[model samples]
Every structure is written in structure tokens, then in C-alpha cells.
Target chain A: MQNGYYIGVDLGGTKICTALVNEEGKVFKEVTVPTEAEKGELKIVENINNTIKEVLGDVKIEEVLAIGVGSPGPLDVKNGLIVETPNLPFKNFNIVKAIKDVYNTEVFLDNDANAATLGEFVFGAGMLTTNMVYVTASTGVGGGAILNGRIFRGSTSNAVEIGHTTVNIHGRRCGCGNRGCVEGISSGTAIAKTANEAVKSNVPTSLKNYDVVTSKEVFIEAAKGDRVAKEILDEALSYLGILFANLANSYDPDMIVLGGGVSNGGDIVFEKIAEEMNRRALKPIREHCKIEKAKLGGRAGVLGAAALAITELEHKNKKDGYIIYN
Target chain B: MQNGYYIGVDLGGTKICTALVNEEGKVFKEVTVPTEAEKGELKIVENINNTIKEVLGDVKIEEVLAIGVGSPGPLDVKNGLIVETPNLPFKNFNIVKAIKDVYNTEVFLDNDANAATLGEFVFGAGMLTTNMVYVTASTGVGGGAILNGRIFRGSTSNAVEIGHTTVNIHGRRCGCGNRGCVEGISSGTAIAKTANEAVKSNVPTSLKNYDVVTSKEVFIEAAKGDRVAKEILDEALSYLGILFANLANSYDPDMIVLGGGVSNGGDIVFEKIAEEMNRRALKPIREHCKIEKAKLGGRAGVLGAAALAITELEHKNKKDGYIIYN
Candidate 1:
């Protein structure tokens, strides 16, 4: 009997990352390609299929037990459908069914953030703990909660949307129509928007030098001792600190792992966030939870999907007549 | 095989409520007595012992499987000790060991909020759904979460502290040293405080007639078409609505059951909160979740503790050669 392998795919607005991994979660083969999401749903689905096939390459087809896809959401995870994604031009697309039809194999789909959380939990920063909250501060702030080593999918499989949980009431206008959400104030997009607005206001800062101020440039300026840039970044980080503190008090997780673009600010960002979290969170959480940076970088998405596939594979084995090959 | 019974104790600052219940969650007997907590820890422990004995009167000792207690927290659940309670004069008191020594049977302990959530989940408003959030709006807002029909204790067994989660960034000073927590704006005490502050400001209202305005008087005045009363109550209810909406987004529970003193404000409060929640929450949550008043009244605490005992009994049966009778 051959030990089974898994295919993990991370589908994004601009790119699709896929990999082939064994039960041990070691990636021995990988592939990446542009998603070209603007081309429409069919093209995107076809691209996903092609990416998986490319990753499979010369491997024995029957040896691959399942495939896991981490896609941008809102999604219908239970039914394996992409409900509607802001970045991707897909609405109610049955990506899982399409892939299953071509490969005739098992498929699992979850929100990209949740998948990355699992990746971090199974193979990266969260390896030391069973319960962890993974926060991604990318173009948008996204969150995933792993409770008891399993993703905490609430009634609608959309729970743990920590980014949207209100940190400031009636403070800022969020895209989702909420006022003062973490996403509205602390996301990379939010930081870039703040910096751009400051430029438009003719703020006395070196940031005016950039044609378009990115969150990265703002961090660089802040690092170079720019007062205005420091103020904007500090405000954003403070809101994040408050958000994390609130999460710690509510969820009381073992560890909080921070990831994404903004987190690349390195030790300064991590230490500042930890101090703010400790100062503001409830007494118990301040003493108990460890705040840390996510260790898995580019591979978190695919690895997380692979981990999900492993979980699903085990569930399937217990339900069906299948047996695990060790 | 003989069927088992459970004894549950609800320990409060002022009273101790104890009950005996069968496996099906039907309460057969109960005993209530003053805690006289200020008399000190020894007297409080003796009072708890007496309450248990009174509830156990005329019962066959061999049929009782375990005893469960729901006490005021922030306490150590795993070790069965009260960390420190503001109302009760106890510091690191080993209440569980004391009870266990008396009964010599399996004993379980949890915070009152967690127990009440279980009570609601097992036999009250939460009986209809597997995943429910129980929010108590008494002296302070307390919350408990039941996921897949089990209590969701976080990594440190201190999860679901919903009241402490911030809603307004700088709106109100919470007792926990946070700004704008649900407990600071929406609890029964919070409502009363707001009403009193309005009175102190010399607002022309019927509330001035009372020597001390309570949350109930505020509700009564609101019902009588008092503008200030209505405004105060509306503001409190709105904050609660924001909180519930945030919780719905965070936990995505099938239902949110409201209990305790403030929740007793009836349909006006319930309908107003429901309307505000629907107005603010995401589309899917607005469509899926049912907001309802808690059914179990005075019995919530004792029943919740009883439910904890049942869960512990089952866990014990699965582990250490203990058998459960059908």
C-alpha cells in the first residue's frame, strides 16, 4: 500500500499557489501562476484546475488522497461554493464541484484566512499551542481562530471574523457598513488610505515624495524618524493592539500569531503590539497569553489547506471503509 | 445498573441555591439560604455544606454520581478554587475541596455564567439549538458560549467574557479599566447609573421622584412616555444591540438568549434589541440568528450547575471505569 499524498491550493485575486505534500506536511513539489481573476469565473476555475494538475505532475494519480483549496471569501464552505469574493470575479461558483468532476477525488474548501491559521497551527508559529488566533494584516485585516486544534467554524462557517468586530463604536466608516471596525482603521489598506489622505491634506512630511503612498513606505518613513508617519502608524498599531486585547479577553487563546504585510515591520511591531495588548487586556489574559509573529511566510496558505485536507481525510476515513496508510 | 442523580449548587454573594436533578435534567428538590458572606470564608463554606445536605435530604446517597457548583469568578476552574470575588469575601478559597471532602463523590466547578449557559443550553431557551450564546444582563453583563452543545472554555478556561469586549473606544470607563465595555454601558447597574446621572444633572423627569433610581424604574418611566427615561433606556439598549451584533459576528451562534434583570424588560426591550441587531449585523447573521429572552428564570444558576455535573459525570464514565445507568 502506498502512503497517500495531498494537494493544497491557495487561490488569490492575483495568483494561485499550489503544492503537493505528504502526511507529514512537508512540501516536496509546488507551483505558482497568475490567477487573472478579472477574466471571469470560468477562466479562474480553469486556472485553479490547471494549477492543481501542474502540481500533481508525474505523481501516481491514485496515491493523492484529496485536494484542499483556500480561497478568498465570503464562501459557502459546507456546499463547496464561492459565494462572492471582492477580489475575484466569482459569484456562487461551485469551484469544488468543478475540480472534483475533473479529478474524481475528495475536495475541501475554506476561507483563505482560516486555512492560513491552520497552516500556522500545524506547521509554524502556533505549533506550541492547541488554541491560537491568527490575524493577517494584509490589504485587508483577516482573522481565523483555532479552538482545540480545530477551526472554530460557527453556525454559518463564518465565525471568528475578528477584523469586523467593532473596536470603536461610531468611530470610522467600515466597508461592511459598520462603524469603527478593526478593518476600517488598522488594515494595510486603511494605513495606505490614511497616508494618502494626509498627503492630500498637504501634511508636512517626506511621504509627499511618493506618487502613491503604500503601507510599506509609511513604515519605512516611520522607521526613518518621520513624525507624521510615526503618528499614523502608531494610531493604526494602537487600534490593532486594542483589537488583539479585546480578542484575548473574549477568546482567551493560548497564543496570538500575527501575519501579513504590516506584520513585516518585525520586532518593533510585535513588541509594541504586545505591550499595548498587555496594558489594555483583562488581567488574566495579560498574564497568560503570548503574543508572537507568524513564522510561516509565503507557504502558510498552501500548508494550511494541506492541513485542512489531512483533517478532512481523517474524518472521511473514520466514516467510510477507507484506512490510513502510514 | 442504577440511574444516577446530580446535586448542583449556585453560590452567590448573598445566597446559596442548591438542587437535585435526574439525568434527564428534571429538578426534584431544591434548598435556598442566605450566604452571609461577610461573616467570612469558614461560614460561607459551612453554608454551602448545609445547602447541599438540605437538597440531598431523603435521597439515596449511592444514586448521586457527582456534585457541581457554579460560583462567582474570575476563579480557577481546573483546580476548583475561587481566585477572588468582589462580592464574596474570599481569596483563593478551596470551596471545591471542601465540598468534595464532605460528599466524597466526583465534584465539578465552573463560573456562574458558564453554568447558566449550560442550564439554558440543556433545558431552557437554548434547548432548540446546538450552538447558543447566553448573555446575562444583571448587576453586570456576563456571557457564556455553548458550541456544538458543550461549553466553550478557552485555553485558560476563561473564554467568552463577552461583556468585557469593547464596543466604544473611548465612550465609558469600565470597571475592568477598559473604555466602553458592554458591562459599562448596558448592564442593569450601568442602566441605573446612567439614569441616576441624568437625575443628578437635574433633568426634568419622573425619575427625580425616587430617592434612588434603579434600572427597573428607568424601564417603567420609559414605558410611561418619559423622554429622558426613554433616551437613557434607548441608549443602553442600543449599546446592547451593538454588543449582540458584534457577538453574532464573532461567534455566529444559532441563537442568542438574553437573561438576568435587564432582560426582564419584556418585549419592548427584546424587540428593540432585535431591531437594532438586525440593523447593524451582517446580512447572513440577521437572516439566520434568533434573538430571544431566556426562559429559565430564578432556576438558571442551579440548573446550569446541575448540567455541569451531568457533563462531568459523563466524562468520568468515559474515563475511570465509572458506569452510567440508562
Candidate 2:
């Protein structure tokens, strides 16, 4: 029982990654397959089940404690339903029940952000911290917090929508229809968008050498000492810094773990973050809260889903007065 | 005992308010006295003890469950020391030890903002809510939160420094040395500063008739259709709205309770807050998080201290396996 396995399913529009993870956060078996989203709802769900089956391998279903699925939202996590999402074809689909019908074990469902946060809390950079905020600076700025040793899913389970929070009162308008959202100014998509605009405006830069410029090219050009690219990154990372500083001021967490594409911008990303935090965060908070890079990289999705299962199972066992062993 | 009594002390720069509160959150006895802060550290401590004594009246010290004191920061709450604040004369003073010596009971100390948050959570506007954020907008803006039915005191107990969180990056510089902090723009002091600046600039306004302009004067003038005053309030309240919207986005709490002087500006303040929240917050969050005025009013500080004692005692009892009756 101490060596029990948990199944994790990372449901995405492009692919469904399923893994069997052991108690020690090791992947025992795993399989990844195309989601084939355009092939229709039932077909995609079938693909998910197939991946789960592939990961199960020779292990008996009884040896698995629980299954956890992480997906893009809006989701009815309490009822284990994927209400709807832009990428996924789910519309009021009961994903947990569908998985449970075949496996007949306990299942948990959460948004990808919360799952990733749990992953960091349990086995990644946020390990051992009582309060941690996991921020993903990808195409959008989204986050989740583990507070007081538990996942904090605000009143409507929409807590930690950090990207939507305003940074500059009269700054750029966001797709969410808000002005000055950090996501609108600092996310990977935003950075690339700014670079493309600069190129279209014929601003003097090495970014124009590339037929198309993305955040990846901007980072490369900035590293090569391109002034325009450097300025774009400086502005974007400064806003990112403001976002991090705001988190430090608000949560006063033990650490803020950075994840997603933009976080991988290396020294420049961390340097800007540190600079803004020093300038903006309260003295005590800045000194106390550690800023760290997320440990999980490409495998974050699958591992996060696995971590969700392990953590939720532990919570359920605790509530049911069952002792858990290492 | 279910009928237990607790002592609450609201330690402010100008006054010391002490009260005996019952299990039902009702005040049994109360006393207010001048802090005489200029009389030095030991004198302030003595004054605090005297107020506690006055509030105790004929009740024996043994009947009191615990004592809670709420004061200005920067405090070392874990060690129960007043680390030193602007108006308070105490420097590295262990006020908790002094109070404990006099009463021989458990003593708890927290920042005034956290105490007020506890007050709202236990007996005021935030009652019956599992997650609530209490924001005080006065001469300065400050706040605290009760998350998952417990006070979330981050790593260093400085959690929920919402005022210092950036609302308008590149906007006004805060006294905290951070740019665009909500406190620098939305607070009563900030409002007064803006109005006074407008008056000094000889803006065409009825505010010129007043020899001195405070936030109260600005609110009055705005209510009376003074355009300049109205503009000042609109600008300030909009930033306040951003702060509130950020809270809603980050915490997704059940409710945000507004307290202190500026919150009393009535409809104009609330309308601005609502408009900003609608314009800024995520749809799900905006639809769910209720914005309410603090119920404790002028008595927030005293009652908040009481709530802190009660909440902490409940936490202690639960941890020690002692069941709370109320």
C-alpha cells in the first residue's frame, strides 16, 4: 500500500499524456498520443482512455490509489466536469465519471494551473514551503497558490487568475478586455506581439532580419546585444517583475516558482525579476520570499497531474481518518 | 468554557482601547484611554495595562481565556515584539510579555490589519465566509485575509500588504518607495494631498473656500457637485477599484470587506469600485466575489483584537485536541 501507484492524465488539445507515477514521484509507465480533437468529442475521450490503458501496462488497477486528470478550463472540478475550454472539445463533459466508469477508483480533476502548482508544491521547486505561488508566464499569465500546505481555489475555484490583474492603469488593453494586465504586456505572446509590431513599424533592430519574430527570437537577439530586442525584453520583463512584486506583497508566500516559456529566458528573466522585487517589494517580504525557477520542464503537465492525484488522495485519506505511509 | 471571556487591546498611537468580550462576540466591559506615547516606552506599556485593568472591572483575571493586542507595524508578531512604527515610541518592545506578566494568561499579538480581518471574519461583514479579505482604506491603505477559514500569515506574517501592491505602474510614487502603489493614490491621505495640490495650483473650484482641505472636505465638495473635487475622487477611487479588482483576481475570496474612513464615502466609492471590478476582474471572479462595507465601523480595532484572540484560541484548542464549544 505504501508503494501504491497513481495514474495521471494530462488532457490537452494537441495530445493526451498519461502516466503511472509511484509514491516517490517517479514515473513507472507513460504513454503520449495525439488528442485528435477535431475528430470529435467521443473520439478524443477514447484516445485519452487508450493512453491511460497504455500507461497501466501490467500493473493491476487495485494497486493504483487514484487517478487525476488536469485539463484546460473552465471546469466544474467539484463535479469533475470539463465545462468548456477554448482548445479542448469538452462541453459540460463529465471527465472523471467517464474515467471512473472503466477504472472504478477514486478520481480527482483540476485545472492545469492548480495541478502544476501542486506539482511544484509536492515535488518541484516549492517543496517543503508552507505557502507558494506557481506562476506560468506563457501565452497568458496564469497562476495557482499552495497556501498553508493546501491548494487555494478561491470561492469559485477561479482564484489566482494573476494575469488578469492590472499592472498599469492606462496601459495596453488585454484580450480579457482589461487594461494593463501583466499578461497583456509581459507574457510570451505579448512579448512576441510587441516585437512583431516593432518590426511592422520598421524600428531599427536585428529582429527584422528574421521573416517572423517570436519571443524566442527576441530573447536570442537580445542576448546578441540588439538594442530594440533588449528594450522590448526590458519593458516586458519589468512588467513581469511588477507582477511578481505584487504577488510577494499580496501572498507573502515562502517562494514564487516561475514556470512556462518566458521563465526560461534565463539570467535576463531572473535578473529583471530580482531587480523589480528589490525596488518594489516590501523589505521584509523581498528578503523572506525566495524566487526560484520551476524544476519540472517538458514533463510538467504529466507530473503535475500525477502530483494532483497523490495530494488529493492524501487529503481524502486524512479526512477519512486513514493513516498514510511514506 | 463556552461562556469564556477574552481581553482585546487596540494599541494605537493616539489612544489605547481595551475591552472584555464574551464567547458570543459581545463586549461586556470597555475602556478607552490616551496612549501618551510621548511618555516613552514603559509609560505606554503601563497605560496599556491600566486600560486592561479598567476593562476587567470586577472580573477575575483567571476568568479571561486570553488577551489579544493589535498594533501598528513593523511588528515581530511571532516573537510578540513591537519592532517600531512611525507614531509609536516603542522600539524592540516586547508588549506581549508585559501584558502576560500582568494578566498571567495567554497573549497573542498581530498587526492591526490582520486583527481587523479576523474581526470581519468572526463577527462582522465576512461572517460565514470561508475566505474573506478585509481592506482598510484610511490615511493609509492596509488589509488582511482569512483563507480556508484561517488567518493566512505568510512566511513572515506580512501577508496581505495589498496597499503596496502596484495598481498603476508608472503612476504616483508611494511612501513605501514603490511606484503606483494603491496606498499612494487611493488612500484618504492621498486624496487630501491631491485635493490640496489642486487648490494650490489655483484650480477653479469651490474647495478654495475651505482654509484646509482633507479627504472629508473633498468627499463633501464632490457630493455637492464640485467638478474638481469629483475628478480627484474619481481618479483616486479608480485606483482603489484596481486594488479591489486585483484582490478579487488574486484571492477570489468569498467577499472583500472595506473598512476605515475612505470606505465611508458611500455610493461614489462603491460605484467606482464596482465599475473597475466589472471592467478589470475576470467574469467568473467578478460575478462571485461580493464587495461589502465593514460592519465594525469605529470599533473595528477593538473588536478585531477580540476576534484575533478567539480565533487563535480556537486554533490552539483544535491543535491541542480540545474541542471548542462555540
Candidate 3:
């Protein structure tokens, strides 16, 4: 395998973080810049290019292999186009072409969660197992799957719309206009909303003292033995476990890696999840998979992007040419 | 594309039925015999061999292009051996070798549900789609997945276990030692148990007329608009809908083919399922996919077995005289 430097960019709604990663996933250089997305598509393009240049910083750009970008969906990942994204200002943006304009090299593109899964598969907790699922519990429970050691993007780019998996047929109304999705029931936003409602409903909760109760505040209070906080935590954990059990029952993954802000609850969350999953999931698999905290922290997204860059390059080399056919 | 004669053997626990099928999946001659499984494994082997001979009595032996067998599981389909099956008396039965011994020809084997799906995929309602799911709603929800035009047996050859999918965490117990499996809530056997309990629990409504209540009796009363019957039917439908919706959401198959005796509820059941799936599934796919009645009916298992025989032969031919490893 050829070991070379490549650029990995995390294209967020408000900012862009670009890094120069060697083949071994070591970040030699990195930097960030404001996306200024509202200024129009041109500004976002210029910003990504600028961050890329800064990350490269005369580190023999001629030797660098490819550039990878992880963005929100539903994206046109095949064409490297951002299609109808909710968070970013651009729609149907030819991101790969734009990055090519700046770097004049090979480029890799995929959904943020997908890139993150590849990152985990090759370099994180998922490194030990091939069949696995990684879910990022941010605003919503975005997910990506590695089935049989490959990212399983269905015939379309939208295969693992896992957050949309119907955990409850008649549960809470999800943002996707469905009910009882993992995201709808136990997202960070959902947990905060539940806490707020309980406080307003005079549920004798410690969360009433917060300016606005969030998932973080609830976890902190729950650790202190507050009844309302404990109840809310229990509710969220059970729903998350059910969601994991669903994934386990269907795909029979060897491991499920949890990421994002909500996972900060640590052992309290992990123990409950394992217990509930063992109770709900089919035997052996429920006991088979070891659900633990993610080894990659906040930098998981960036590291995943780098892994995507290397994997795409390696796959291209395997086919004896850089055939970018989707 | 080649059309020829094929032998299909329904290797059941109690009976062995063998039929001769032309390229059109039309049976020209058929024969049946008691399995006599209690006579031990050798007698059962003799029963199968005699059934094949009787089915093709007048025809030349060389006229048979392929031999296929459909039997219960869990089985090592790849190795042509039956594993520990709950419905059968034999353990670790080397079915392929046994059949090959009598005929001195190629014999193919598959689990019953897998065979059923292949039958539907090639010659039934699923003919239009390369990807589909066939679920048999009998004692338990035995199912098979046709993914990308091939039957998908996961790492263990025991995938597509539709009955065990957990629909509710705090719901009924399942036979597979899991909580709230789709089978526990909606299988014919599970439904009959629920119907019996409701009638005995003395819910103030109709359906006490039958001394022994069953899933069939419940359906008969529900068709007439009885309140208790309606309630039981509704519960069963809701759970079934959830199971179907989850499969739809997860796999995004183009069609779902329903088989087994319970599917005789037919339009009444499908109409209710359509209503719930449309209201519950993720957007777009919510309206996507046609849930249709399976066309292969009683002979599905045999035809599927034949299809598998042909497929296995073709797959073997693809690797230049080398068998492709799964």
C-alpha cells in the first residue's frame, strides 16, 4: 500500500475544518475557517479551499493523494454534489469538482455519517470487527453501516436512514414526519424537550432550575440522584436500547459504536443500554456484541474523513485505475 | 434461459412429496409418501428415494436436469447438511449426499422459507423486482430475503429471521427467548393463544360461541364485525404492520410477498396492512413498495428448491471450474 498525505475536511453548517493526514492517519497539519455559507455558494467554496491550502502549507502538495469531505444529507454522494441539504446553504453543489479546482487531485465524497463509519471501521473501535453499525447522536440520530466490511449504502445513497427506523409505530413525531424513530425518541434535542415538558408539568425535577434543561444537565442531575432526572434518563436509555436491539436483531452486527454529545453519559448510559439490550435482543448477539464508549472523541468526524480518503484511494488502486464510477 | 425437466422434493417432517417440473414450473407428475421419520434416518432416505422414482416412473432418468429439496432448518445450506431443526427428528442430516446417492446426479438443498422466496422471486408476485421479501405467517414468521436477485443467507446461513425482530421492549415474550418479537405478537400460533386468553378472560363481547378458539376462529368472527374479535384483529394487525414497516424501512425492498395459511385472510389483512404502512413508514418509501399475495402457493417450496439447484449450478460454472466462496 502506498503511504501518502491527503486532505480531510469536515464540512459543517457553520464552519470547515481541514486536515492533512498521512497514510497512517497522523494529522501533520490542520486548520479551520468560517463557512460564511449564507454569503452564497461561492463563499463556502472559497472557504474550503482556503482551509485546504492552510492545512497543506507547502507540505509537498505534489505528494498528497486525495481530498475527502464529509457533509450532511440527503446528499448526492455519487456525483459529489450536495443535494437538498437542510443545514447548508448550497443545494446540488458540485463539491468534489470545486475541491478539484483548488487541489487538482483525486477526491472522495460521502455522507458525514458514512465517512464516520468508515473512519471507525478502519481506525476506531470498529477496527476489530467488520460487520458493525455506528450512529452519531447529534441533533438527530444519523447512522452508517459497514456490512461485511463495506459501507452499505443501498442502491441509493440513502440506505441506512437508521434514525428513521420505526422504533415506535405511534410514538413521538419525528422531524422526518415519521413517529418513534431513534432520533425522534431519544436524540439530544428530544431528551431536552422531554425534560422541559416534565419541568413545566410540575414533575418535581431538578431540571426546573436550569435556564433550559438539556441532555447534559439531565445527566448531571441524574448522577446526583434526582428522581425526575433519573426517570428522564431511564426513559431515553430504554428507547436507545430498543433502537440498538432492532439494529442487532436485523443485521446481527458484531459491534455497535455510539458517538456524539449524548454518549458522554458514560457507564450509566452504557450499563443500562447493555442490560436493556440483553433483555430485548435475541440471545447470544445481545450478549455477543460489546457495546462500549467510542474510542474516537470529538475528532472522530475528521479522522473518519481521513480514513475515507485513504480507503477510496486504495480501492481505486485495487481496480488498477481511479475509476470514479458510483 | 434453458428450459428442461427438474425434480422437486418437498422434504417435510411428516410427508415427502416429489414432483417433476418442466421449464415453465408446471408439474407433469407428482407422488407423495409418509416420511416415517420415526423409522430412523435410513427409512426416511428410502422414502425420499422412492418418492422421486414414483414421480418420474415412466420418464427416462436422464430427462431430469436437476434435483431440488426444500426442508426445515436450522441447516448448513452451504454444506448441504440439515442442522438441529425444531420441526424435524433428525439432527445434522446430510440431505444432499443422501439424495445424490440414489440418483448419481447433482442435488440442491435449501431451507423451506428460502425456497419459498426463490419460488416467488422467479415465478410469483415478486417476479417484477430483483429485491423482495417473502414472509410465511404460519406457526412462526419464517421469512426469506431476495437481495439483488440472490437469496441472502448471512454469515450463519440463518438470516432473515423475521419472527424474532423486537417490536416492543415492554411487550410479550417470544419463543426465541426475546421480548416483543414480531412472532410473539402476530404469528398465527401467537394470535390463537391471544384469542384463547381473551375469550377466557371474559372480555364482554362476542366470540365465546366456539368451544376451542383458534387464530382461524378469531378471523372468522372479526370478519363479521364482532367487537372482541375486532380488538384482537386490530392488535395482531398493528404488530404485523410494525414488523412489515420495519423490514420495509430497513431493506427498502420493491415488493413483500405474503404466503402461508394465515395469508388466506387475504384482502382484509392486506388492506389493513397498507393503511398502517402508508401512515407509518419513512417518507417516499411509505408510498413505495407493493405488498402483494404470493402466487406460488403450495408448490412454492419445491419450485424454489428447483430454482436453487439451477442457481447453484450456474454459480459453480462462473468461476472457471472453481466454486466461488460465499
Candidate 4:
């Protein structure tokens, strides 16, 4: 029963979710844990390892082929290391080897968004598509590309930092220490930050002064024709339009699958983004693409990691039931 | 000599240059003429046709395999038609068919910049590389991408519009109907425009009295330490650095080839650009890339078109003389 199991670990700052999936993309079991990241790198690694063990409690170690871990970057995918990631205290950590040591199997490591893209490609939106782009617009914007059905890591693994491409020269300052990044304008934090400032500025709107207002509330209020909310919504949509247009210009993908908490705003954001991208994007480009929300939701991270392992399994299957390459 | 004659034309707004290249990436003969848009599209077409005829003068028609025309877009590359390029005037014309009718051979058409990138791949800096980016900082900030050694055109002809990607959200307005585009910040026009404004704002530079100071003059003055010029240089370099970093994150090219007039500024621009890109680009990305100047000059245009054709020939040879689908 456990002969072909694979593991997926979603390593987040506040929570960790690990899943045991089969080659058919079905989750057999999952374990979720609170990640006390402030407790430092060793603690988080221990937490991640425990989550994997719990997910595999009923399965034999020999049954698992490999474990896939998805977390924030900057990561060295080639050497399976996390090099100075900001959220976690780990500096130049070889997380892949450590996980392999425990699981006694090979491990695959990738940036969280990239892993999610792999997840979507297999069990989610990108199924059967030859070329696609998956962009996550949550705390910060990030992207991953699938070209000819293979993960496209730019020459330096520096590919797909879509959030940092400048949308406005004189736009807001981003946490990345740069200005006008897509994340600076479209992420959940940015939206909430905008909402808070407008409420404080005494802008005429239905939104009142609240201690904190998330991007979710802004979309909810804007739907009710709250003037302040619309203004904020328009700003976000405009930035999104430009960013989408730029993405279209850069990667001629067949589809762009949007994910993250903000995408949950639905048509409130989609319509405007479509209009602007169409208006600005030109020739063989304008309507040659379709923009859609990512079909997989909260499970994208965990499932995506599973998808990675499943893909590895398929590749191995092609070579007489052995992993293609280490 | 007649066995392998091919025509390549690089059409500019002010003039048109046509070359008849042999199979060895060498120009056997060429002709150049003025393109008077004011006189209208017909005249320009006539001039273009004459240049083609002149280049062919007495050469055996059967020797030519195909003709490649590189002009400013928007155009219909598939049908060999010119839609309505920006710099060139023609409400919407078909230059490809026009040449095909006169020359009686197959024809190929692409955006001039894209044509130049293909040229670079076959005959210039991108010669041996697969994943690469070509940015021409001349009249406008034009970009072309060679992914796996083939020109990557988006769904529409508008793919690879690097200049339109904003480096400054609130900076200058762009002609593509956007604001603060990469072109508006880093193009030759942008540099000269910024220098013009700096001079007008009384930034205390030695250039205050010049009727007009170009990007070249600005670079020279900046090299000589004029404060206004230096400040403008730094600003231009910063914008370019961010632009380059974003492209790196998106494309993950092994190399970025810089061209155009400003690129000729060489080390002054390169040093600052490399520093900023290295500083801003995320990890695992900066490791496997190199930034180099385009070795081909004005010759890149015609040569690129010629290279485009020659590569096909070499590919045919590699595949045992079977023509591959382009």
C-alpha cells in the first residue's frame, strides 16, 4: 500500500503543512503544524521534519521515493540549499540534504511560488497546457514559468521575480529595498496599507477608521460602491493592468493563472485587469492569451509539492522504474 | 556565387538598406536609399523595391532562396504584410508581398529589433548561446529575446516590448500610451530628454547654454564630472539596472547583450549597470549570467536578417538537408 508514496512540505512562517500523495495526485494523509519561526532555524527545521514524519506515520520509510519542500527564497535549487532566506533565520542552509537524511530518500527543493506552479501544472490549472505562467499575489508577488512542460529556471535561478519588475518609477517603496515593484502595489500588505492610510486621511467613503483593514475588506467595501474603496481598488487594478501588460510582453504564455488571497476578490479585480492589459498590449499579443484564476486554492502549496514528486515519479517510470537523475 | 544569393533588407524610417548575402555570413553586395515618408508609402515602397532591384542587378534570380525584410512593427509576419509600423508611415501596408511579387521568391518579415536579435544569434554576441536577451538602447529602448536560439514572438507581435515595462511609475509618460516606461528612462531619447531637462532646471552644469545636448554629450560631460551630467548618468544607470534585473528574473538568460548608441558608452554604463543588477537581483540568478556589448554594429540589422536565413541553411545541413519548420 505504501510502495509509491511521495511527501510535500509547505514551510511557511506561521504554519507548516505536509502531505503524503501518490503518483495519481491524491493526498493520502496530511499534517499541519504551527511554525514558531522566531524560535530560529533549527526549531523550524525540526518542526518541518516532524510534520513529514507525522504524515508518514502509517507508511514504511522504503515506500517513499522523495520529499519536496517549498519555501521562500532566495534558494539555490541546484545544490538544494536555502541561501539567506529573509523570513527564516537559516543562512546558507542545506535543507534538502537534512530532509533526505531523515527520510532516507532524495529530496527536491524550490521557491514556494515555483513549487505551487508545479502543483498547479499537475493537479490544478496548467494541466495539459504546454506553456503557462503562475503568479501568486499574496504577501508579495512571485511567478514561475512552465515552458514546453518543464520548469524554466533562468540561467541563474534568478528567473520569475515578477513582483520586482517596476510598474511605476515614482510608485511606492517595496520591502525588497526597491521602488514600484508589483508587490509594492498589488500584494495583500500593500492593499491593506493603502486602505489604512485612506481611512486615516479622512477620505470620503463608507470605510471608517479601523485599527486594521485587510485587502479583503477593501474589496468587500468597494463592491458596495464605497468611493474610498473604489479609488483604492482602481489604484490596485491600474498597477495590475500595467503589470499584466508587461507580463504579456515578456512571456507569451498561452494562459496566466492567478492565485493568492487577493485573487479571491474575483471580478472586482479581474475585469479591470483584463481591460487595461487588452488596451495596452499590442499585436499577435492582445487577445492571444487568456487570464484565469488558479483553480487550486489553499492546497496549492502542499499539492504543488506533491505534484513535483509525482512528476519526478513519472520521469523515473519512463526510465524503467528508476529516478531519471539525482 | 548565384547558387546561394539571398536578399536582406533593414528598413528604417529615414532610409532603407538592402543586402545580398552569400551563405557564409558575408555580404556579397548591398544598396542603401532614403525612405521619404512625407512623399508617402508608395514612394517608400518604390524606393525599397529599387534598392532590392539594384542589389540584384544582373545577378541570377534563381540563385536567391528567400528574402528577409526587417522593419519597424506592427506588421503581419505570417502573411508577409506590414500592418502599420510606428516610425514608418503607411496607414497599413504589405511590404513583404510587394517584395515577393518583384523578386518572385519566399519572403520572411519580423520587427527590426527582433530581426537584429536573430542576427546577433547567428552572427553577433548571441552567436553560441541559447537563452539570451538583446536590448538596443538607440532611438528607442527596443528588446528581442532568443529563447533556445529562436526569436520568441508573443501571441501578438508585441512580445518583448521591454521598453514599455515601467522603471518609474510616476516618471515620464511613454509614447506607447503608458507612463514611466523603461524606454522613457533609459533610451537614448530618454537620456537626452533628461539631460535637456537638467540643463533647463539650472542644475549648474557647463551645458546650460547649448541649444541641444544629446545623450552622447551627456555621457561625455558625466565622464568629465559635471554635476548635473553625473547625476543624470547615475539616474539613467539606476533605471537600466532595475530594468536589467527584472529581465533577468523573468528570462534567466545566460547572457544579456547590450547594443545601440548608449551601449557604446561602454564601461561607464556597464560598471554601474552590473553593480546595480548584482545588488538588486535575487540569488541563484546572478551567478550564471554575463552582460556583454553587442559586437555587431549598424551592420546588425542587415546582418541579422542575413543570419536569419543562413541559420536555416545550416539547420537544413544539420538535419541532412531537410527544411525544418520555422
How good is the docking of model 4, by CAPRI class? acceptable
Clashing pairs in 1: none
Indicate the worst ten consecutive residues by lDDT in candidate 2 chain B.
B317-326
A180-214: candidate 3 lDDT, tens digit per residue: 77788788888888888898995687788889778
TM-score preference between candidates 2 and 4, better one: 2
Error of 3 at A151 (Å): 1.8
lDDT of 2 at A195: 95
DockQ measured for candidate 1: 0.65
Ranking by DockQ: 2, 1, 4, 3
Predicted candidate 1, C-alpha RMSD: 3.6
Backbone clashes under 3 angstroms, per model: 0, 0, 0, 21
Tens digits of per-residue lDDT for model 4 on B1-326?
12588788888888888899875567888888888877888888889889878888888667787777788888766555678866677765777667766777656777788888888877788777878999888778888987655577655556688877756667788777767777887888888998888777846897775777999888888887788888887888788877788787788888888989989885888988797677666555667767889988988888877765565555444553212323
Error of 4 at A26 (Å): 5.1
> Judged by TM-score, which candidate is best?
2
Residue B286 displacement (Å), model 2 = 1.1
lDDT of 2 by residue, B205-294 (tens): 989999999999999999999999999999999989989999999999889999999989989999999999999988999898899999
Compute each candidate's TM-score over C-alphas.
0.93, 0.96, 0.89, 0.78
Evaluated at residue A274, the lDDT of candidate 4 is 87
Regions of candidate 3 where Cα sits further than 4 Å from its true position: A1-3, A59-65, A310-326, B1-8, B19-30, B54-68, B103-108, B201-206, B209-213, B319-326
Docking class of 3: acceptable
Tens-digit lDDT track of model 2 for A162-181: 99888886667899987889
Q: Considering summed lDDT, which 10 consecutive residues are worst modelled in model 1 chain B?
A: B317-326
Off by over 4 Å in 1: A1-4, A38-42, A89-91, A318-326, B1-3, B319-326
